[model samples]
Target: MSATTPSKLEKMLKAGHQAVTSECGPPRGSDAEAIKEKARMIKDHVDAINITDNQTSVTRLCSLAACIHLKLAGLDPILQMVTRDRNRIAIQSDILGAASFDIHNILCLSGDHQSFGDCAAGQNVHDLDSMQLIQTVRHMRDEGKFLGGEDIKRPPSMFVGAAANPFADPYEIRVPRLAKKVAAGVEFIQTQCIFNLDKFERWMGEARDRGLLEKVYILAGLTPLKSAGMAKYMKNRVPGMDVPDEVVARIAGVPKEKQAEEGIKMCIEAIQRLKEVPGVAGFHVMAIEWEEKVPEIVEGGGLYPRPKLD
Candidate 1:
């Protein structure tokens, strides 16, 4: 069989671009079947699938290896790179390795601190934060030089992405920090799951006022809460996450059996509202275990798969 081309990911990022993307969580063991099942479910609904890098500091299969498998399975994969495990050398090597497989999309993240995760015995190796990692990729791609000042036979082509948290404390501090990432050569940004559109709009307005939105693609993140307890847990425990009081109340008001439906409705509403915002490039749905509902949410938002281009 012939290898599939990444026209979908490329077109979504390059076409007069209104894009929609989502993520896939890696399974606990060497079970490729679970990842394949989720990929098969949402493959037609999104432009690309992001394989997270040891998300929440939990041990899982390698994201890069998973991404390669997803690519081989005919899905566009964005290999999310976190600095929690690798230094600049390993990061650059992964970028090169990803390029060899024709997987070029990347998201740079600082990742969760080791203290927050179950792996208490695991040693942390955050040699570079998100911004520096993005800059390193930019240097490798644009300057054609690796961190060691070594030349490459062929420079990698990457669509660099970074993460932002609009809900971080001191809104004043959060906004400028995003500007710094954009200045550091981030090509796109996927925000943390947003439950408060009003606050997110305020932040986006501020970003536009600062002229940051004009420089890169910004995909608003949305994750459906599985239940009221999940909502509460995300609000109370998930660092850098902000679930608004009204959202919590909405979840609380739902009958115990109806919370998932209510959450999906709310997520659809969030995506619709985000589409109206001036600078939004797309939506990044972090559905977690609720990946099956992504198609429903996307259809609910009035977006459908664009016909494949010839």
Candidate 2:
């Protein structure tokens, strides 16, 4: 359906009751024009847009503010929240603020460690981890109580999301950790960028057996590699990320001019295979500066809009 359809956010989430979702990264500066352009490009194509909270630990326009802008533009946005700079007080306040703006979706995260970002010297305040943040949001909504036990006049309606890394070392550990988050009340989960579908399928199978899949929405993350160098950088330097050798070879075999096309092809293949997995809810595309290529990937995945059901 077109974005002009009424109650787009509600409609999108309901569709994803067993559907797919994707995310876009906002630019790093205050150029509202750039953000608006990016939003307009993907708004109709995706079930929801996720505004990153200082992604890669670089300072940028606030996720809450960006989400508000997307809402005004008639797109559903999932505000990505990181606890790096805010105390619980500030985090709770932002939740209430977003609710007041009628923005209800959120992705709770602890953010990157200080050492990983450009500002290593900055103090890191991990006042709450992702799981704790999910519980906190649920508490606020269910009890109408703030963190301090004070009653809120009217608690904000929120759909809580969290991240999971299936590629982490020791599948044994990662699988159970996902269960912990599900137990903590996360309503949805966007996974780390997946390059190895077999491994992801194994993880998903285990998730289903453990009963985690039944409790939350799972959106597989796919980031298109820009070049062989990027593939290597992600494999070697990016912590908590893994790219398989076959994928690297595919990018390496490609001519420099064709690298982006090869990358998109690889992403489409991943999304297709992920769709076949029983517990998979959708895919979340993190295109970084290549946000414009998202439409191609979405179409390539054979996920373009179908006729709206009555």
Of the candidates shown, which would achieve the greatest lDDT relative to the real structure? 1
For model 2, residues 1-310, the per-residue Cα lDDT tens digits are: 2322233443554565434456656667777777778888876668778888888787778888888888888767888999888899999999999888878788899998877667878999988878889999989987899989999987878778899999988778888999999889887789999987888899999999999887877888999999999999999998888899989999999999999889999999888878889988778888878888888888888777722534
lDDT of 2 at 263: 92
- Candidate 2's C-alpha runs over 4 A off are 1-18, 306-310
C-alpha lDDT values of all predictions = 0.86, 0.82
TM-scores of all candidate predictions against the true structure: 0.95, 0.93
Backbone clash pairs for candidate 2 read 20-282
lDDT, model 1: 0.86
The candidate maximizing TM-score is 1
Q: Write the per-residue lDDT of candidate 1 for residues 231-273, one digit (tens) a residue.
A: 9998898888888888889998989999999999989888888
Off by over 4 Å in 1: 1-10, 307-310
Residue 5 of candidate 2: its Cα lDDT? 22
